[model samples]
Target: MIRSAYSHPVAEVEITELSAVPLNVVELLSKAHHPKAGAVVLFSGEVRNNNNGKEVAYLDYEAHQIMAAKMIRTILDDANKKWPLNIAIAQHRTGKVTVGETAVVVITASAHRSEAYQANQYIIDRIKHEALIWKCEYFTDGSHQWGGNCSCH
Candidate 1:
C-alpha cells in the first residue's frame, strides 16, 4: 500500500518521509535551519524531459513504504555519524511525477559548508543506491520500464 508521509524522532535526523504528494522545498529548508548551522545544502532530484534518448512523459514511483522509510532513516543516521550535522531531512515522492517535478529531496545543515555538502551528497547517493524504491519511466511513445532508481546495480 502507498503511504503518505512518515516521520519519527531520531537522535540526529529530524524527518524521513515517503510522501505521495509533492515535496515542499521551502518548508524543508526552513526545518533544516539551526542557529549553529553555517550552511544548509538541499538536493532536489527532478524528473527530466528525457532519459536514455527517449522523450519522457512522466515517472511513476513505487516503494515498499515501511521498508523504504526505515531505510531512509538508517541512511540519515549513517550520515549523521559521519558528519557534524545539526539537522537532516529526506523526502521522496511515491506516485505520478511529471517532468521537471522533484522526486526526491535531501537537506543537510552543518556548521560548515564542507560537511553539509558532503553529508547531503552521501545521503542522496546512498538512497539512490540502497533505498527500496522502484521507478517506472514513461516515454512519450507510451512505453515504460520498471527499474531501480539508479544504475549502481
Candidate 2:
C-alpha cells in the first residue's frame, strides 16, 4: 500500500535500546518525504547464534561514541550523494545484546529498487567496515573474539 504524502520532515537519529524508530519507514519515505519514491528497502542486523560452527551465546558491542556517530553520519551523507536516496536512517546497538535481538536497522528509499538495494548494501558494508564500532563475540565455550574485522572465520 502506498503511504500518504508526508509534509513535515521527520527526525532521523537514534542510538539506544529504547530509541524510537520510524515505525512506518516505507510510508514515511514514500508518502511524506519523497512523493516520487517508488521503492523502499529495509534491513535489520540481528545477533546471530552460529559463527564458524560455534554457537554464539551473546554479543557485546563497544564503540568510540564520538567517532562512531561521526562515521555513521558520514556514511549516510555519502550514500545520499552517491545514490538517489530520499530518506535514510541507519542505527546500531551498543552495550550488550542477546542472540536474536535487533542490533542494527537500515532503511533506504529511492525512486527505483536498484538505488534502494544498492544504497542499503552500501550503508551496511560501510558502517561495518569503516565505523568506529567493535563487536565481541561470546561463544558457547565462554571465550570471545573480536568481530567487524573481515567477518570471516
* Model 2 lDDT, residue 123, Cα: 91
Write candidate 2's Cα lDDT for 34-118 as tens digits. Answer: 5666777888788888787889998888888778877787787778778866666777777787888877777777788898899
Could you give candidate 1's per-residue lDDT for residues 71-126 as a string of tens digits?
A: 98888878777887777889999999999999999988888899999999999999
> Whole-model lDDT for model 2 versus the true structure?
0.69
- Highest TM-score model number: 1
- The TM-scores of all predictions, comma-separated, are 0.89, 0.77
Off by over 4 Å in 2: 1-34
The Cα error of candidate 2 at residue 59, in Å, is: 0.6
Query: Which residue pairs collide in model 2, if any?
Result: 5-31, 6-31, 6-32
Which whole-number lDDT from 0 to 100 does residue 118 have in model 1?
A: 95
